[model samples]
Target: MSLSPAFLDELRARTSLSALIGKTTKLQKAGREFRGCCPFHNEKTPSFYVNDDKGFYHCFGCSAHGDAIRWMTDQRGLPFIDAVKELAQSAGLEMPATDPRAAKKAERQKGLHEAMEDAAAFFTEQLHGIAGADARAVLEKRGISAETARTFGFGFAPDARNRLRTALKSYGDAMLVEAGLLIQVEGKEPYDRFRGRLMIPIRDPRGRVIAFGGRIIGDGEPKYLNSPDTPLFDKGRTLYNLDRAAPASRKSARAIVVEGYMDVVALAQAGIGEAVAPLGTALTEAQLERLWRMVDVPIVCLDGDAAGQKAAMRAAHRALPMLAPGKSLAFVTLPDGQDPDDLVRSKGAAPMEKLLAETQPLVDRLWQAELAAEPLDTPEQRAGLKQRLADLIRPITDASVKYEYQAEFRRRFDAHFSPQRRPFVPFEKRTGGKRPAGRSGWQPALPVTEDAKKVHAAGIDRVLAKAVLAGLIRHPAEIARHMEVLGSLRLADGALGRLFEAVVDLAVEEQALDSTRLVTILARSGLGDVAGELLRADTMPYSFTQKSADPVRAQADLDEAIAILVARPEVDMMLADATSAMQSRFTDDAFERQVALVREKQALELRLANLVQANEDARALGPEEN
Candidate 1:
């Protein structure tokens, strides 16, 4: 039972060597491949490696090497035919029948491959001939050297429609047409598909020319044209320069994805050989998988213009669902209006190298793209941003990775939209010992006296402070609503002040702040003693302090406490100033101001007393009534 090479190649491409070997080998991802102990021999250190991209397994210990079928035969002890049949069945491939027609078809494909090679040879000859002087000039203008041109198999397709057909007539017109070298119609005779253009050969993994991409020499509507899908090539699965870049990527431990073939060539010219490009389309899943096989994180270096950015985002979204642990993409945004090719030409490869070195991970790029998708000023727009982020994270198949992405996005959203306050500073330090200028010759109100400081310090109720802080911890969602009021008022107790600041900062940074996580983070930040004291059972009898407290009533009570706390400081400041003014002038207006301050202070005290009384009454009523 003989199988065609095409069938075997397709089988290898479809079958994942890692999944097959992992059944017994316990493989772990190591860079672009999976590594485990060699199953054929006793070894604890994991010398055996499997590469699904290349569809092969190798053992450094025993020097065992083969592909899917070989593994099935050697490891499973199956004969060649049985192994091939099993692999074919698993790969969803029908084993090729031993028939005359099947053999003829395989032979025909072989002829097609030969025909494409012949066409490439002819194009290369024409590029160096007098007829290709213009093409050579184009290459020179684009900084393509003669050696690089020859190495990449650069060639020219003359303007004449019959030039390629005439040169390769011995291979038969049908073969050339089937190979995508000539255009055939029902009524019209077959003619050259690529004419008056510069030709670059597109090859497979084994470095065999499977197709050609042609770029027009001068101004034209469709500047670039690629060969149509033939039996030998699938454009969506093919990447330009992959044949040459795979090994370079292995050595460099990275791969660079550019937008065009010329960019790959330019980077290669600049001595960076691990670069490839999609064949005239947005990156496909197959293409991305191929890139991941070469390196865990391939740097997608697209142009920095609007269209290019849009293309980069398209690649990112396409890759989201396919992301796995240790397998993802990184992106490099070239200088504005520039590409890898342009960057290399202008400033040498150093800038391009730097950009590649500092590539942004796919998640970061996705966040940035969605952040810039629309304005987040309105509530609806902000909700849309959150919804979009959720939508992006929904496609990720890995549970752990998806959870991490959700956390990261939530953190970013909170940081961006939540109100952030500067670190607290002393008034003297903030003012640099000089008061800010106000209206000319109108000095600001005098500072509070030492007596007033002592009065205000003694006025802060520790029980009230602990109750408020505990309530916030219990219902962390209410923290955002009270952030503005809480930010303005300073807690008088040192431990309480640090705890309050930590809670506010946590609310600003973490959108999904549960009581447990809030408390845990606070404890980690060296506030464990303060947190424990605040959360103690006897800390306060307020409904908000209890775990079973009604969120609505608790929030209301918390808001009331916050209002009283904020008002107290304002009243103290006003009363101190009014007292000073009365002592200095004793005018009717000043006396009235002092009277108003006294009344306001009395009202705030009454409110605080009533709040404590209401909580105690609720506590007496028990959890059901409260």
Candidate 2:
């Protein structure tokens, strides 16, 4: 069996040299190629290079060079025939049958090439000829320039079926039929296959015309038509504009995959020359392999229409199972109802360029696509979402890449449904514990301003509440231990209440916030001014809130202040009740109650008096404490 040159090129194009060798030798990306220590020789620094573009592995150190077939034979000890057979199978190519016509494979291929090229030239000339004026008009209407038309070999097949046959009779009917230019019916003459359509020539890697694609000139069925799978053309294996795109991709460091030939042509016209398109089918794994040979991550530009989004989704799903580290796809969907052609024509190229520049990664697109697939409100639904994510992750071919993707999903899952802390709520009037947890109190600071000397309008309770809140901002680490108790406190100042809630939320969200980071986070969350005012030393002359301040003394002052604040409210209620009873016609029991209430009020007043003296003493010793 003889393998044709076209088949060999296809085979090599379908293979990834880095992957083939990387199975055994560790490899790392180096720009457009992969590099590692030469597997053939022992070396410390990497001197080996495997270039997917050139389809070969080379060692600068040991002077080794070979293609995949040769690597299999020399590196893996496979025989030549065995290597060829294995590669053909992997590339989805069948071994040619050994027939008497096998020896004339080259001649037969040459004849097919002559016929296809002739058809392409005839189509072009006719497109320029008198009969092709309508096709030329169509091109002009689509904004296809003369230079682009010539560069891509735009042409139009005559409406009549036999017009091309008459023009290319020299290549003979048998050759024309074999080239897929004419379709044959049983017991009937073959006629031109593409009729009344604008023609596009598909070229091989070396820029040889291998097949033709046609777009109907006007309203018709089968909007786009491609050449059948002939000896020279396999639509599934071919990407439109790849011959030009491969070289262009190297310069831009990006390969773009669109959905159609006009999309490719439109981008090239807009100065984006690295665009390609699958041949009338969803992007295939083989085509993806070919794209990776040019650039690391190629971008898939789809239209924003529903069908376009579905196409983008289809490509993403096909790519998921094939993902490896440093090898994945990026996606950018154009505006609704706009393909690349429409986008460039309507908005110029800057918008499209900006969109491509900000293309999302594969995993992000995956998360977004799957997340939007269904609503995740219930536990079962959320868990199902996780399972969907895991299902997508499970297909990743690389173990390390799979693990990292799993980790990414795990992070997203946590962010979505982790135990939600109570939303940041402003402090409200509330009754909590009647006493402090311990001797919670704080240290005193040097009076920062005359403002600090102002007496609390609500007296020591307000002063103490302000003091405790300020201490937390100075020492956020102390928050974790007293979150519940602090959460229960109700402050009189509304702004101060909001600040308290924000600080508690911050503490709960981040368990290990230091004073600096905590303050920064709060400042970023629109609380900079609030935090500043609440934490200002000038708010209270006797407040201590510096790195050098004693946490023990701070807790002591805070606890004592809390106990007094909580107990003061109860005392007021008792005094009010006793005062009410004493005001009414009272018996001996009511009289006793009044005496007891008076005693309680006196005791509470004494405690408040001591708190005043403690503040005075703290103010006096503030300089010494600092």
Candidate 3:
């Protein structure tokens, strides 16, 4: 089968050479290409390389080389047709039917390319002629040198209607209309589509003029206009200045995206050659993919105005679903009320270079955009912010990148919303060598209080203690309700006491506390091990300890457990005192008191036992009930 060059070009553009060659060889990134040991010959060091941007593979050691089709036929031992078939299938493209019409279509497209080139040359001649005096003045006013204009193939469209129609009349009116150079109506004659405008040719990767972008010289409704999509041009898939920018990007190890063709030209004039621009539209997925083929992270430098920021956000949203490891976008916002063109004109290229040097990653820009979307002063607004973030990251297809983004967003959310902790200072330093206003200079050192001694004497139920602490950690919102009662209580285990104190302090510090943020804070404070121990599945048989338990039910059960825990020590202390009094002086009242205290302690223990049994039943019923 004789395949058309158009179909073959599409195949090459769609297939990633690195990925195709990587199946048999371990290829590591080496600048703009991938390098690995030569698969064609025995070698210890890497001498083979693949350049996806150029769609070719070369082996320095064995001189083995090919494109995707060559690799499939030579290495995989398949025929030409089979190789094309396999690549077409993988690229989600339909195999072109065996027909002579496809060849004719390709020939016609080649003719259209010739027509576009002729039109470009005609416009360039007109730009240097007498009719282009106004165009030259416009370029001069914008600080574009004659040399720069010549390098970029700057041109002009005369204000008259038939200037191009008469110049390129040999290509026929049909070819000119097909090339998007002339507009045709039902009965009216086809005239030039661009008039009284400065022209910039849009070229393909091979430097063939595919279309033109025209900027109105002065006083126009639309300041800029682009050619309609034709066989040679798909605006969404094309980036302005890509033919020149690709090689420059490979050398710089970076690529930049600006808002307009003029900005790209300005940057190029300033010796910044690795810059391109979308064709008067928001950045698209095809353009982003094209950029990634050149560099790992391309910098998108949009204007700093509201529309520019919105355009940047749109680009970010377009990139999220396609993000892969080491393949993402960075962003740069130019100074206020200025674009790359304006900045270069005012302060030269240093500020533009500095901004590019310090570009923000896609994640930071996403966070800032969402944070500034609305005021997060209310609970509802804050929750909306988190929900928006979740929605934004949900589209990320790469598992590892998605996970990292989630973790980073969570960390940022906690850092932004959680209150800052005060730095610790010694009491003497804080007081500046003076006693507190209400306290005497010399205060008595008190002995171990009665409550502390009683807490030590009454051995705690280890299982119940774990359950209560875990419940509090899982449901941090309930901490404030029980803070006063818990403040006066003491635990015998030093680690457990420290954990309790930390929890209480966190509750006091953060107004909006969640379980994840609470655990994160505890982990940062070196209480992670203790917290982890308490949160173990086998450590407690309680609904509140389960992570997926219902919030209302968890809070209620946690409250009951806390009540029982707090009242137990008092019952134990009263019981001990009554028994001691009875032993000291045998009396009926003392005996009665000891009996009542014993009954109260038994009731508390029984309640604790029932609560555990209820939790066990709930656990057996599964998470629905919990």
Candidate 4:
């Protein structure tokens, strides 16, 4: 769905940026803006700056800045729809449905959430009623305390089909089906999915009941009955105990991810308040992002079994690219055949706490595990291991973490593995045949792409967007000048342009607007990063003169910039190709026809290059030069 100016206007009018961001991270006044360490990226020094009066935040460290909607989407890992919904909720503003489809989705989500809540209440009542004795006995055997069960909202699903089905009949069969309370029979009635089991209500990080997990009391075919995939509940996306653990996770600057409902409950019960687990599913990016939102360091607490260790490794591998600087992961090994639940019950909270504190870094675990499995004594084995290590480390994009592992590998292998060895005769070594640089005779090149450069240049539209926005705020009359420039470009119709329009509308309303307020309003609209990039893009020289600290220095810088732009051979070549294609439009000479759209884009780039150069020269010569 497109982000419209009207939606942004509604969002800005309703919500306060400080209240929204302040709830997650501690913010303090720094000049006119509020400063806090970024919640998206780990940082010891504050880089997340929020201008309360302006209503915008920018993270200089990670380059993650956006309005409240954008912040909620990026920081809380919520989908765009959910992010808007959350902001609307915070503002006590009911977001109007843009379409019937959105309304239907919302209705389904609401019904499922409501059903889950009702089901939880039903199970809780049962736990205190007829099924209470059996469930409590099981908890006692598992060494779970009364307080622990209460804290986790533990319940019991009676062996009857009509128990919750009867209680929630008013919600209708569709709701029951969505909530996974009843399994459908072809051309017949629905039957209870979870019966004769202890019910565990699974909640999202916001403490909203979205689903249920039921563990059978005794011998059963399928051990657990999890809620079906519903609008509100996605097993892969939801983390068990996230709601209870997130506040603590933020406070501690760390979170522990376990594998089961019991593990999370046991950890929390045993005083490990920062522990959470994925709901009846493998770790997913959604869950990882959620964990990322809460804390800087997220520890993967795996059970000491083969399957569990494998799962932890998979999770770490998946998380590698998304792992920003300062964010860390550790692997904690419980005793063999023991999970958090078993360990906490057997050894108490202190041992579990110690294990968490003493968990090994994920990278260290990987290297240690790799070396232990491979016979690295022989030169061939060592060399193979080195390549394997490099291959494993290649996917790790985080420079700091990747380099740390590289340094560790160097330290471990330098003495023996550093020396070059050959399989052929010693005489062949004199021929100077060394292994080809990079992996498998094919290595991906760095230093950006032509497309990336195009995209970066396309980013100039963003600068103009910011200019249009800033101009509208400062001198509403100047907005027409900026828009005229923008109109000539036919900038891509998307979030950036929509935001520019929103700023213009606001400027029209305010008469004289503040840039920070515009930024804040833009931030609330959920395009903070795009707006920030636009605002932070290259400053034009005459514009600087208009806000003059010094026009002469600006002019000199502008001239140098233009010279640099003109010297780009690649850009010039691209521009020449574009202009030739444009000229071809008038001729019927069977020429090497340039692709129409690509040619126009290239021509635009050429025009931009010339414009930049001319602007630079004009700035260097002062206002009289124009």
Question: For each candidate, what is the lDDT?
Answer: 0.83, 0.77, 0.84, 0.67
Candidate 2 global lDDT: 0.77
Candidate 4 or 1, higher TM-score = 1
Best candidate according to lDDT: 3
lDDT of prediction 3: 0.84
The list of candidate 1 runs beyond 4 A from truth reads 14-52, 56-94, 423-626
List runs of model 2 lying over 4 Å from the truth.
Answer: 1-3, 7-100, 419-425, 428-626
TM-score, cand. 3 vs. native: 0.66
Better of 3 and 4 by TM-score: 3
**How do the predictions measure up, each by TM-score?**
0.64, 0.59, 0.66, 0.55
Cα misplacement distance, residue 288 of candidate 1 (Å):
1.3
Location of the lowest summed lDDT over 10 successive residues in candidate 4: 586-595
Per-residue lDDT for 1-626 in model 1, tens only?
45677888888888988988887779899987899999899987989999876778899999999999999899999999999899888889888767888787888999998999999999999999999999999999999999999999999999999999999999888899999999999899999999999999999998999999999999995899999999999999999999899989988989988999999999999999999999889999999988987888888889999888889989999998898888888989877899888999778889888888888988889998899999988999998997788778777776556645755776577667755444445445756885444413332234456755665766554556678888888889989988787787656758788898999999999988999999899989999888877777654756678777556556766887878766776688778877777665544466556666666776676666655654564455455433
Q: Which residue segments of model 4 deviate by more than 4 Å?
A: 1-105, 399-401, 415-626
Looking at model 1, residue 466 earns an lDDT score of 74
Clash count, one per candidate: 0, 13, 0, 12
lDDT of 1 at 253: 89
